[model samples]
Every structure is written in C-alpha cells, then in structure tokens.
Target: MIRHLGLCLLLLAAFWVTPTAKAATVCTATSTPMIFPQAGPTQVDSNAVVTVTCNTFGLSLLATARVRMCLNLDGGSVAPAQIVPRRMQNSFGDPLNFQLYSNPAHTVIWGGSAAPGVPAAVQIDLEYGVPVLGGAGTATTTIYGRVPAQSGLAAGTFTNSFAAANAVLTYRYSEALLATPPWPTSCLAGGNGGASTGFPFTASAPVASRCTISTATDLDFGNVPGAIATNRDQTSAVTFTCTGRTAWNVGLDNGIHAAGTTRRMRLGTSANYVRYELYRDAGHSQRWGTTAGTDTASGTGSGGAQTVTVQGRVPAGQMVPAGTYADTVTVTITY
Candidate 1:
C-alpha cells in the first residue's frame, strides 16, 4: 500500500510540472481609404486623416512590434508601394526609432493607375512595441499633400488603402477622411487693388507773352559832321502790354542784330548803333536801371501794362552817313 501511494504521488507531481499550449495572436492594424481631387491648378491644397489601432494581446513588456503605411497608385486594384516609414513615438514627442515619408504634391487619376506623369505614391511604415500590460491602443495621424497639373492629373477621382501587421497581433481597419482644398481670392476694387491709375493729370504748356517795341528816342547826341567824336548820349522809351495779367521780368537779350539778319553785334558798338550810357530817373529808379556801361537791364512789370525808358547815347561821328542806318534790338520777358 505504501509503494502504490508513492506511485500516485509521483504521477500527480509529473502532471503538475507539465506545461500547457499557449494561444498565438498576431499584431494587426487597419487604415482608412484616401482620395484625391481632380482638375485644379498646379498648386492644390488637400488633407487626409488616418486611424490606426494596435493590440499587444497581453504580451510581455519586452515584446516589440512594427507598423507600416504604403500608398497604392492606380487605385487599390494595384499593389501598394512603401513611402516614409516612421517609428511610433512615446507619450513624449521623441521618435521611437520610426520615420515618415510624404510628398506634398500628390494626385490621382482614373484607369486603375496613378496620374500618368504623377510621381510614385508615398508610403509610411511605423513600428512600435506593445506595453506588457494588456490595453487597447489607438493613434490618429494626419497626412497632407498638394496636387499639381504637371503630374498629368486632370479633374478626377482617386482612392487610398492602408494595412498594418504584427508577428502575433490582430488589427482592424477604418475609413479615412478625404477633403477638397480651400480656394482663396483677392477682393479689392480693381484686379491690382486700385494701384494703377489709368489717366494722367498734367497741366498744359505755358503761353508765351507777346512783346513789341513801343517808342525809341536818341539822347544826348549833339549834331555831328566829321569822323571821331566823344561824350555822346541818348534816351529811348520802351512800352510793353501783357494780354494776360501776369507779372513778367523784362531784360535785354544782348543779341541785337540788323533787321532780318542773323549776324549778332556787340552792345555799345558802331554796328549796334545804340549804347546804354546811364539810366536816368524812371518811375522805379531803384529797380529799373542799367549797371554802369553794361547794356543789359532788368526790372519787374505789372500784370496789365508797364513802360520803361532806357537812357543811352552815341559817340560823335566825324562824318555822318547820308543814308538812314538801322540797328536791331531784342526784348525778352519771363513770368
């Protein structure tokens, strides 16, 4: 009886030491479908949302896993290509040995193919570890890109798919949100916001004043008969009337010439035939007068009318010419 009891105890010990078969669970994940916009300018704005869930299946804390995202051009009908793969991040913003790849300029087309000239689609793969403690895990990530016309993509439709997997974990897939980009415009008066004023606002050309020689008289020229003379003097009165009531400055041009002739003669010369000897009294003696023997004269005039008399003289001639000799004088006015 003692031997039999020992045998039963040995059998119980063996049964207690035996290990039981454990169930296997694979890590899995699901992603929402992604869509793209059709006809648009080179630069189009768009956004997409993806939801990923992971299950550790009550694994040990030391157990690690990986997640990947891929883009399938030409619709889900074709195989997905890997793009940027990022490691999952912890509660902190630090990366968990992960990376992400994306092309902001991405567009889709029909015919179960990516836009004819469109670049290869982008893909992202993420890898992470399941916490030792059993709990539900979830992450929602946003993906954005722009569509350009150069990619041979016209106004059309597109689709995207996502998948996740682990060695011993299960995953569920969810639909992603695809939205059309917003368009912005300018709302000013003109296309250039009233920047360019079409018409020019400029004044007309100034009207030149019309001047005429009114009166001229010889001063202090005592009668002469022979060649060579001295101390001769004369005076002349010149009157000017402005059609428009505008102030003007009357000055000598020093370009005195014979009538209808281009040749210029110097002031106080025989060819000039007129010399400004000295300025006598005038209404405004202080302002209207010649500078010593200088031929030029300067003075202001009233708007309606004004007159100035210039005092001058000629040298005695040894023999006075018989014929009438004429000299030209020029008067210029500026307002």
Candidate 2:
C-alpha cells in the first residue's frame, strides 16, 4: 500500500510538471500597405490586408487553444490627439487628412493603438493536430481607409508610415479540451494572460493636377437693327476649376461659319455672312484664337473657380439683308 501511494505521488508530480498548451503560444502578424489611386476633391478609399497567426505546440489530439486578440492602428506620421481622423504629410510639410476604419461601411473608426478608441478584436482557434494550419490559427482582416473630400493646395505624394508600435496586435489566450464551453471574450478579458506584437505598414497616395471646365453662356449680341453701321460689342464669361499651381491656357475656335480664319455669322444656312470677331481683352486688342501659344489666355490656377472673359465684336461695315444671324464657337483649354 505504501508503494502504491508512492506511485500515485509520482504520477501527480509528473502531471504538475507538464507544460500547458498556452506556454508554447507565440503570435506574429504581417500586412500589406494601403495604397490609393490619384486623389481629387472627392473622398478616396483604400484597403490593407492584415493577418495574425498564433501557434500552439506540443498538444495532444483534440486539444484546442483559443485566443482573444485586439488589433489597433495609431495615428500615422501625422500625430493627432485622436487616432480616428489621422493625417499624412507631403515632402513640403503640407497635410492631407484621412482615417482608418474597422468595418467596410467605414462607420467604425480603427484606433486603440494606445487607448480610448475601440481596438479591432478577433477570436482564434488553434487545434494542435489540425493539419489545416499545422497546429496554428490565423485571422485575416481588411482595414478600410479613407481620405475625405478636401481642397488641395498642390499636387504631390502624401504618405504615412506605421511602425515602432503604430500598428499593434495584442492578444490573450488559454488552452482547453475540444469540449471546453468557454474562452476569453476579448483581448483584455483573460486578465494577465496577454502579450503584444507589432507589424509595420504604410499609407501613400498622389494627388494629380485636375481641372474641369464648366459651361458658360453664349455670346448674344442682342438684335442688330437695320444695316451694319457701327461696331457691336458683347461679353460672356467662361469658368474653370483646377488644382492650385496648375497652369492653363484658354482658347477660342473659329465659329462653324468662318471665311479663312475670319469668324463670321451665318444668315439662316444661306451664302450671306456677317463679319464678327472674338477677343481676349475688354479693349478688344488681343484677338482670341485656337492657337494655344499665341492667342490663348493663360493663367495659373488657385484651386478655385476662375473666369475668362470672352469678348465679341461685330465690326459693322458689311452689306447684308436684315435677318437673324448666329454663330457657335468652341472653347478649349490647354495645360
């Protein structure tokens, strides 16, 4: 009976010396950079793929390890009091505002690289003998990113680098039999059974110089009464919007009815013509023409709506029957 008791003691000692599955658990993480296409006045979105892998070693069949993990992203190169709305910077030290999200809808801000904001969470299950992941479980998640609509000052590359703890993976884990009913509910739920890791990443995008020409009113010279007698002048405005610092030139094409570079107004599809001209200045000194380098109006963009005055004139001295006359000229911009 003494020998039997001693054997039981030995078995108990062996049981106490055996290491738990959680002891061998070591987690790691990696990610792809979030990159965006050309940015504009409207919001632009992007995605990054993050993967977390937790390993469980030296466990028998049917043994399982469960993990509660929190994934957090801090403010990038541009540090803000809050991590929800982060900012990136250009080489010139200019700022571009952007944000990271946990959900596809982008309603849930991705933060908690430090605290306060909710950290992204995941539940991982590692079956020791499962060949699928070779005794390890992995969780893959997508990080949604956005750059809100903004008026840009210049066209250049904006970037943010996430490293040295900016991107973090904090986790808590426990080992149990396959039939165990419960596990940690969150990364912080398992008390002291937690650790953290880091993975570096970056966010970058370029804003190309963009320009749009808005339509304008036609040059209406009103009604020309009787025969051509004096010069008739009218003005119209053409508006264009572009990114700051962009150089553009505005040009005017000869109307549909033109006689060898001379703009003319037509009389109801007949052979009759009325001589009319377009100019770039109010004084009508600079004749506006389609030649971009010579006769086009040039200016630098201010990232706001800008106007170009289209001055029209009828150098009245032509003999024609009194009838309705019209002409349509195309407006073009060269950058």
Candidate 3:
C-alpha cells in the first residue's frame, strides 16, 4: 500500500514537472493609407513647388517598413508614365518626358540642374523600434515637386494611392493642392511709373474783340426853300463809341432801313443823288467823312475808337418837292 501511494505521488510529480506548451500567434495591426491635400485635379505654375504628404497609423510592426507612391497616366500601370515638357526647355533644348525611381521621388522640377525627365515618385522607409503594447504607432513623410516653365500641360485630375503592405497597415490620402507661379514684375511697374514726362503747361490771352452800336443820333434836315425857291446843302455826323479792344477786320452794312424796302430817297433828283458815300478825315484817321447823301455812307475801323460823319445835299428845282426820307446803317466786326 505504501508503494502504490508512492507511485501515484511520483506520477503526479512527473505530470507537474512536464511543462505544457502555449500557442503563440503573430501580432499585426492594419491602418488605412492617407494622402494630404486630398486627391483630385492639380495645377502648378512656372517655378512652383508642390508638396505631397503621406501618413500611416495603427501599424503593429516592430520592424522596418516602407511607403511608396506611383502615378498612372491614361490608366497605364507601367513603372513610369510619359511626361511631356510644355512651355519649358529641356537640358538639350528638347522636350522632356516623365520618369520613375525607388527612392523618395517627386514630380515637376523647376529650373533645376536635374533634367526634366527625373522621377516624380517617392518611397520612404521607416524603421520604427519595437511597437509598444496596444499596437499604437504612426509614420509620416513629405515629398516636394515643381513646375518647369511659364505655362504647362492642361491640368487634370490625377488618381493616386498610398499603400502600407508589410503587415496589415491602415493608410489615408488627402486632397491634392496646386501651387501657382510668382506675380509678374512688369505688371507692378506699369501702375506706379510711365514713359512720358508730365509737367509745365501754359495758356495764352484771348485773340479777338467784339463791339455793338450803343446810340444813334436822329437825322436833322436844315431849312428848305418853297416852290420856285432856293435849296441848300447840309451836313450831319452820327458818332459811335467803341467799348472793347480793336477788332481784327471791321466791316459795315446797311442794317437798319425803312420797313419792307431797301431803297432810300434823297433830297435831289431820284437817280443822281439816291446813293450815299462815306470817307475818313485825313486829320483824324479814325474819323469818317461825309459824301453825297446819308444812305450810302459806310466805313470800318480796325485799331481804335473813331468818329463818323454823314452829309446830305438838296439841289434847286423849278418845283421843289416837299417830303422827308431817312435810312439807317449797320456795322459788323470779325477776327
């Protein structure tokens, strides 16, 4: 009985001594890939810089990891897509094409030593230390690119993806942002400065003068003889005063007269003495002289003020007519 108890105890001790293996499972965490600035259409001006950011989170890996970016043109999944340099000159003065590489790559290089066809894609490898409990970790990187010339290809929508493969990793991509070229220097200069000189203006005095008739004296006929009587000649003067300066070219016309008729009757015979004449006195060059009658006497003054005279004469006749006749004159001036 003691021996049986001993064997049972020994069997129980052996069972306790033998270690039970516990199954171990590989640890892994997945995160969604993300791109910054969203993903859509993109445009870049000449000498512009474009930035692309990729972020990875919730990765459970304690070892090194890598992130890569690739571009597909016209749905072409090839390693590299063709990029045609537009409005830009290449190293050899030829058009440039697109290229790709494994190293962190970027697109759109500006006036840089690197040729236009350089790779535009990039890959970033992150070697994170052992992951802490709860599978919490994150990785981020940025890629820069540039535009080459004043103008480039018509911008369009480009689809890109950020993928974290080794071990389940979650990643996300943000919208794409476009960069514009610098402002034009010539446009700024035109606003503040110009080509011509703007200064020193002058004005001159007036050139011509004007005048109007202020007053006109009434006509006075001297005494007249009765029929079968004697007749006498008489003279009278109508004076005008000038108010303004000298007129350039002065002229005169018969402005005033008996209503409806342009004719005037004289004291002598109807045909001989019907018209009148005007003259200037030698002593007073500005003063005018009298003539046969008062209807036709007219004159002009150019420089200064002057006097005007009118004269009339009646001839003797067998039967002297008895009546009164009169007319007026007008004057005009021009520059």
Candidate 4:
C-alpha cells in the first residue's frame, strides 16, 4: 500500500510541474461592402453586414469567453458628406454626399469612438476547447448606407472606399468557466489584450445619363379678327431638367402641315393657311428648326429646371377666315 501511494504522489507531482500552453481568444473579422441602388437626383439607401469571428486558439483550460467589439466608422475619409463622400470623376470630379448609419431607419449614424459618433457594438460568447480540437463562433451586425438627394453630379460610377488603413477592427475579450458573470464592459476600454486592426470595404453606386422635359407652355398670339393682321409676336417656354454638366440641344420640328422650312397654321382642312415661324431669339433672326446643332438652343444642364424661350411670330398681310388657327410643333431635346 505504501509503494502504491508513493507512485500516485509522483504521478500527480509530474502533472503539476509540466509546462502549459498559453490561453487566449484570438479574433478575426471580415466586412461586406454596402452597395446602393442606382442613385439619381434622389436619395439612395443600402445596407451591408460585418461578420466577426472569434476563435479560442491554442491550449486553454478556459471553458468559455465573452467578447465585445466596437466599430468606429466615421470621420477622416470615410465620412458622409453631402458633396465629398462619393465622387465620380469624368471630365471633372462630380461630388455626391453620402453617410453611414447603424440602424435600418438610417437615423443613427454609424461612427467610432474616434468619431465621437455612436460606434457600432457587437457582443458574442465563444466556447473554448469544447469541440475537442478547438471552438470558434461568429457574430454578424448590419451597417446602413445612405446617399442623400442631390443633383448636378456627373454620370459615372460613384464610390466611397474604406480600404487600407482607413477602416479599423477592434475587439476585447475575457475568459471564464461556464455560466460566468464577469466580462469586459467595453471594447474601447484601455489595455487587457484589446487588439485593433484595419479592414477593407466599400460603398458604391452608379448614376446614368438622364433627362426630362417637365413642362411646356403654349405660345399664344391671341385673337386676330381683321382682313389682315399686323406682325404678331408671342413667346412660350419649355422647361428641361437633366443631370448636371450635361450638354443638350433643344430643337423645334415643323408643324404637321408645312412646306420646306416654312411653318404654317392651317385653318381646319381648308386651303387657307397662316404663315408663321418659330425663332430661337426675340429678334427672330435664329429660326428654331429640327436641325440638332444648328437652329437649336444649346446649353448645359444645371440639374434643375432650365427654361428655353420659344419666340413665335406671324407676319402681316395674311387673309384668313374667322376661325381658330392652331399648329402643333414638336420639341426635341438631344443630349
């Protein structure tokens, strides 16, 4: 019995003296980029996911670990400025403003402690050495992105890159036995194995060439009840809205019934016709014609309502029956 007791004591002593591997919670993370839908003159929105993976690496007698992560995503270059956040350079740099948020409503902006903005927080529980080989766990959080409504932005792909050292990933962890209460309160707390590293991600969207003619006022010369009328001058307006910095030409097509470049307002289906013309200028020197470059009003869009005046004139010395004379002229906008 005494020999057996000595052997047991030796075995227990050897086990206690043996060297042990360090216990730690090693963590890594990846981010999915936020991609907005096609953005135009209106605000666009999108969302992405950040996946955090925590692994109980090495030999740890710890049964479990609780991790706290803080994501500071604002300030510096990764900001949501209305004009500088997203830029698509064509001939010149077109600036479009955007922002990042933590909530789906987009009311809460996503920023880090450095931003002094509310940083995204993620907490997870991981089991250490429970699976025999090792144990790992993953947690996911969402990031919302929004590009506020703006105009005059050049057409191209607009992107905001959070790459290189622009973005940072950080975490804090504490190990314990099963059903443990004490854990790290904040990841931003100083010291105690807190680690920080950078991760890369992007927020991108595209703007295409687009234009619209919102309204067109009629050119009314008023009633002319006489044998022949004096020279009548009238004007109307055409409103065009297009993407900023876009070049466009507004052309006027001849009426439904016309001879050569002459535009005339026919009286019903009779042989009577009133000679009239549409000009790009008030002096009636530049005739508004179907020609795209020539005889057309050319201008660059400011991404807002642009008014084009159409000067119309009816020459004197025309005899017509007492009735309403009208002509429909088509307005064509070429960009």
Ranking by TM-score: 4, 2, 3, 1
Candidate 3 per-residue lDDT, tens place, 151-216, comes to 121212222222222111212221111211122123112111112111111111111233345444
As a whole number from 0 to 100, the lDDT of residue 331 in candidate 4 is 88
Error of 3 at 157 (Å): 72
* Best lDDT among the predictions, by candidate number: 2
Query: What total of clashing residue pairs does each candidate reach?
Result: 46, 0, 33, 4
Candidate 4: C-alpha RMSD to true structure equals 5.4
Best by TM-score, which number? Answer: 4
**lDDT scores of the candidates, listed in order:** 0.33, 0.77, 0.28, 0.71
**lDDT by residue for model 1 over 16-94, one digit each (tens)?**
4423212122323333333333322233444554454544344443333333323322212112232222122112222
Report how far residue 60 has shifted in candidate 2, in Å: 11
Q: By summed lDDT, which 10 consecutive residues of candidate 1 come out lowest?
A: 195-204
Model 1, runs deviating above 4 Å: 1-39, 58-73, 76-101, 105-133, 136-143, 150-335
lDDT accuracy of residue 50 in candidate 4: 80
Between 3 and 4, whose lDDT is larger? 4
- Model 1, residue 263: C-alpha shift (Å): 62
Least accurate 10 contiguous residues by lDDT in model 2: 125-134
| Per-residue C-alpha lDDT of model 2 across residues 157-249, encoded as one tens digit per residue | 888999847888878777653434245666766622668898789998787777789877788888867877899999999999877767888
